[model samples]
Target: MTGASAGIGAAYAECLAARGFDLVLAARRTDRLEALAETLRNKFGVAVRAATADLADADQLEAFAAEIGADDTVTLLVNNAGTSTLAPVADTSVAAAQAMTDLNIRALVRLTMAVLPGMKDRDRGAIVNIGSVLGFRSLPVSTIYSATKAYVMLFTRGLIDELAGTNVSVQLVAPAATATDLWDISGVPLSALDPAIVMTVEAMVDAALAGLDAGETITMPSVEEADRLIADFDASTLALLGASQKSAPASRYLNVTA
Candidate 1:
């Protein structure tokens, strides 16, 4: 698990530990990571290792991925480490945007690649990628963050197809407003959002695990009618695919002048 120091990641560690899985928790905050590891070890009688690394840094990320790749016992990888910025694109600093992209996209891909070969070789493993509903529709404040999540959504969806025949399972968990420190870090406190939409971290993780048990490729914790939305989205994508196979441009574009 990445970002295992707090919020959703910490919750996942607790749940997974209770399920009798020994854990390797990774995050930047050494203090919190170690504390959580100790707690889980005592409470669940499961071994937990806390690894501290700033994932936005390329050297640290590569080293961490290499270490994880070498661990043959790792059967599940939860790519939960991510960062976000809530400023408009023009107002957001380039450094901040790049940092977000590095942690959210780059780190996730590297870590997933690290665990995949071992899982494929063992022929029994699972990968759970945490995304956001913003992936489907971007807001002004979440433009870049949403784009990264969009990549995650499609990437995991494609992985599902690639790992179809294998015993390896991949799930994409897309959550809406969650009651986590992420809101405060992004400069939007939880109090700013509607109370109705904010879910507790425990509830979100539980629902996601339930979805995984049910063999759902994409899990939306907050959406009540999730199947309908997924079906409609899939149908629309298929229709778009069918429409794009023509040899020539559409008749509407042909009549237009540059």
Candidate 2:
């Protein structure tokens, strides 16, 4: 599990440990990671290793991915490490935007690639990618953050098709505004948002796990009528594909002589 230090990631570690899975938790905060590891070890009688690495740094990310790739015992990978910024494109600093992209998109992709080959070889494993509902509804303030999540959503969807015949499964989880430190870090505290829209961290993780058990490719924890939305999105994608197969550009783009 990446981002295993706090919030959703820490919650996942607890749940997975209780289910008797020895864990390898990765995050930048050594203090929190080690503490969580110790708690899980004492409470669940499961072995837990805390790995501290700043994933936004290329060297650390590559090294961590290599280590996980070589671990044949790893049966599941939860790509939960991500960062965000809530500012307009122009207002956001280039360094901040790049760091968010590196952690959210680059780290997730590298880690998933690290585990996939071993999982395919073993023919039994699962990958859970945490995305956001902002991936589907982009806002001016969520420019880079939403784009990163949209990448996760599309990446997971394509992987599902690629792994169709294989025993390995991949799930994309798009959570809305969850009650996590992410809000504070993004400069938008949970109290600033509507209480009704915020989901408890535990509830979100539980629903995501239930969706995984039910073999759902995409899980939306907050959406009550998620299936209908998914179906419509899929149908629209198919329609777009069919419409794009023409030999020339559409008449709307053509210059017609009247």
Candidate 3:
């Protein structure tokens, strides 16, 4: 698990540890990772490794991927390391944007690539990608972060399609405003969000795992009508696309003189 030091990542580690997954926790914070590893090892009696590496750093990311590729016991990968940008585009630092891109998109893609070949060879594996409910929306302050997560959701969905008929299961877990440090970095406090809307991290993880157990590729923990809505959206979109493929312009565009 990447970003297994805290927040949603930490929650996932705790849950997965209980589910009998020996863990390799990677993150930028060595102290936190080590502490978490110790706790899980002691409590769950599961083996745990703490890998300290900043995924935003290209060298660290490559090394981490290489290490994961070499580890044969790794049957599951939890890609949970991510950050949120709270600022508007004009106010956000270029460095922060670049770092987010590196961690959220570049590192994820690289790690997935590194793990996929082995998973395919073994014919048994699973990947849980952490995404956000905000990925489906155009939030004002979190535009780029939302875009990045949208990419995550779409990327996981693409993997689901590609890995079909293989034993590898790809899941996208999209949580809705869960109690995590994501709010702090996003310029919002968890306490400030409506209590009704924000779910506890444990609840979110449980729901996500439940979705996975039920064989869902996309899991939205907080959306009550998620499945129905997604089905409708997909059907409507396909119908729209089906109508757009034509040999000539529509009647609406035919009369245009320009």
* Tens digit per residue, CA lDDT, model 3, 1-258: 999998888998999999889999999999999999999999999999999999989999999999999877789998989987777989889987887788888888889998999999999999989888877775788888888888897898899999999999999998888888878886777778888888888899899999999999999998889899889977997899999999998999887897
Any idea what lDDT model 1 has? 0.94
Local lDDT at 237 for model 1: 91
- Each model's number of backbone clashes? 0, 0, 0
lDDT ranking of the models:
2, 1, 3
Ranking by TM-score: 2, 1, 3
Winner by TM-score between candidate 3 and candidate 1: 1
Candidates 2 and 3 compared by lDDT, better number: 2
Question: In model 3, how large is the Cα lDDT of residue 167?
Answer: 96
Tell how far residue 96 is off in model 2, in angstroms: 1.4
* Residue-wise C-alpha lDDT for candidate 1, range 1-258, written one tens digit per residue: 999998999999999999999999999999999999999999999999999999999999999999999999998999998888888999889988998899989999999999999999999999999999998889989999999999899999999999999999999999999889999888788899999889999999999999999999899999989999999999999999999999999998897988
Superposed model 1: Cα runs more than 4 Å off: 255-258
Give lDDT per model, in order: 0.94, 0.94, 0.89
Check candidate 3 and list the clashing pairs. none
TM-score between model 2 and native: 0.97
